[model samples]
Target: MIELKDVYKTLDGRKILQGLNLHIREGETYVIIGRSGTGKSVTLKNIIGLMKPDSGEVNIMGQCINNMGKEESYALRQKMGVLFQSGALINWLNVEENVALPLVEHQRHLSKSEVQSIVQHKLELVELEHAGKRMPSELSGGMKKRAGLARAIVGNPKIILYDEPTSGLDPVMSNQINDLIISMQEKLGVTSICVTHDMSSAYRIANRIGMIYEGQIIEEGTADQIKNSQNPIVKQFISGSTVGPLTQ
Candidate 1:
């Protein structure tokens, strides 16, 4: 459902993505694992139109986003959701309002009552049904992430992009988030692209896994295939090794 073809992106003479090509099919949970500063986040930003590629194409549902007009891009953006690494919640808004913000902005036809119901449903989907009135400061790290997930799906988006969903959480919480991600894909059939460094989370949630290094996807395979693959780069990364070609 999403394709990046020979994409190249740079900023102020620094190349962040270099001829990168990747694809995520519909209803698939694709996880991208890469070293810090290797452009994994940049790749996600390009897909979401938060960052533009210098040259090449980003196709979502067959529409080329690289060249879309402002109006067209906004319309296309309505079909996707993003959960940022920091949760990015409105610190001043309650959870319910935060979750409902997308619906309010994008779905003018819906009445407030209807939007509230949708927000409640989404919150429940993420297991935060009773936490709607809580503020960001009142939430734990995992709660904030779950609240972010609730907000992401409040609009019932066709695709969800998660940037480090497991970051800054305890092991149990990380696993819980992983299970929630898997459940969301199974229940809603949404295409998902997760950018993370957590190998265990990636293995748990990804139908297909890709390894990005030095601004390019170096390997792509099924989770089991990734585990068993003999490629030194993949092995070293998944094993959390300090020695490999990846360190060069």
Candidate 2:
């Protein structure tokens, strides 16, 4: 569903992506794990067209996003949902309104009832059914993330990109978020690209896992295969060791 081929990007005189290549199959969860400043977020930005690579191609759903018309780019983005690391909810809006914002902005053909129906379904999927009337300040961190997820899926997007879905939550809440991500995949069958450092979350949610290093993917495999990888960098990373090749 998505392919980044020989992608190279530089920001602020620093090369962030160098010959980065990735292929995400449709209807599968692909998790990317890497250290800080390893181009995980940069890769996502390239895919979303927030930043174009200095060189190489980003193709989504068989179309090159690197060279698309305004209307075309906008249309392509509408098919994808993104859950930012911070949830990025509107502080002024209630949960229901936040969830309905996408439909309100796009899909103008839908009536109030239709929008409400979709919002309700998405909120329920995120397990925030009764919190619709609550404000952002009234929610816990997990609730905020869930609400953000509800807003993301309200439009029934074909792909979901999660940035640190399990970050800053207690173990229980983190597991809940992980399960919710898995639920979204199973229930909606959407292609998922999750970028996280949490190994537990990555192992649980990913059908395929890739590790990025020096701005490119150095390893890609199934969860177990990644867990059992022999590469020194991959071994040091997954083991959380400080004295291996990564640290050396």
Candidate 3:
């Protein structure tokens, strides 16, 4: 449902993505794993049109995002949701209001009752039915992530992009988040693309995994394939070894 072809992006004369290419199929959980500064998040931004590549094409569901008009871009974006690394929740807004913000902003025609119904359902899906009145500051890290997740799916998006969804959480909480991601995929059938360096999380949630290195996708396969990959860079990364091609 998403494709990035021959993509190249640079920032301040530093190339972050060089001829990067990736494809994510429909109804599948695709995870992109890489060390810091390897363009995993950059690739996600390119997909969502938050950042355009200096050169190359980013296509979502057959339309080139880089070439879309304002209305077209808005329509396209309505089909996608993003859960950022930090949850990106507005501290002042309560969980219910935060989850309803997308509907309030993009779907203004809906009545307050309708919006509340949608928000309530999303919160329930995330198992935070009683946290609606709570503020972001009042929630635990896991709860914050769940709140962010509720906001993301409140729009009923066809695609979900997760940026480090399990970051900073304990092992148990991380596993819970991973389970939630898988649940969303199975229950909603949304195409998912997760950008993270957490190998365990990736292995838990991804139907397919792509290893990115030096701004290009060097390996793409199932978890078992990735584990058995012979590429030195991939091995070094997945094995968490320091004595390989990847320099410290």
Candidate 4:
């Protein structure tokens, strides 16, 4: 459902993505794992049109994002949802209101009641139905992430992009979030692309895993295939070995 071909991106004269190429199929969870500053999040921005590549093409459902008009971009974005790294919740807004913001902003034609209904349904899906009235600051890290997820899916998007979905939680909470991601994909049938440094989370949630190194996708396959990869870079990354090409 998503494809990046010969993509190159540079920020402030520093290259972030170099001839990066990736393909994500429908109804599957694809995880991109890489060291910090290796362009994992940059790849997502390119996919969503938040950042345009200096060269090459990014296509979502066969629509070239770099060439889209405002209306076309808006329509394309309507089909996708993003759960930001920090939850990106509006601290002042309560959970329900935060979840409803997408509908309020993009789907203004819906009545207040309809928007509430959709928000509540998403909250329930994330097992946070009772926490709707709570603010982001009042929720735990996991709860905030769940709330962010609720907001993402409230629009009923076809694709979900998760940025470091299990970043800051404890192991138990991380596992819970991973379960939620899996359940959401199974229940909603939405194509998912996740960028994370956590190998365990990546292994648990990804149907396929791609390793990004030096701004390019160097290895990609099923979880098992990635685990057994003979590439030194991929092995060093997944094994968490510091005595390798990657440096601090």
TM-score of each: 0.97, 0.99, 0.98, 0.98
Error of 2 at 76 (Å): 0.3
The local distance difference test score of model 1 is 0.92
Q: Return the top candidate by lDDT.
A: 2
For model 2, which pairs clash?
A: none
Q: List the residue pairs that clash in candidate 3.
A: none
Off by more than 4 A, model 1: none
User: Which ranges of candidate 2 are over 4 A from the true structure?
Assistant: none
Each model's lDDT comes to: 0.92, 0.94, 0.94, 0.94
Candidate 3, position 104, lDDT = 94
Candidate 3 lDDT: 0.94
Off by over 4 Å in 3: none
* lDDT for each residue of candidate 2 in 1-248, tens digit (9 for 90 to 100): 99999999989999889999999999999999999999999998888888888999999999999888889999999999999998999999999999999999998999999999999999999999999999999999999999999998998899999999888999999999999999999999999999999999999999999999998999999999999999999999999999898887
Q: Write one digit per residue (lDDT tens) for candidate 4, span 1-248.
A: 99999999999899999999999999999999988999999999999989999999999998888978889999999999999988999999999999999999999999999999999999999999999999898999999999999999999999999999998999999999999999999999999999999899999999999999989999999999999999988898899898877754
lDDT tens readout by residue for model 3, 81-140: 999998999999999999999999989999999999999989989999999999998999
Task: Write one digit per residue (lDDT tens) for candidate 1, span 1-248.
Answer: 99999999887889889989998999999999988888998998999999889998999999999878999999989999999898899999999999999888878899989998998899889999999999999999999999999988887789999999999999999999999999999999999999999999999999999998767898999999999989898899899888988777
Candidate 4 off by > 4 Å: none
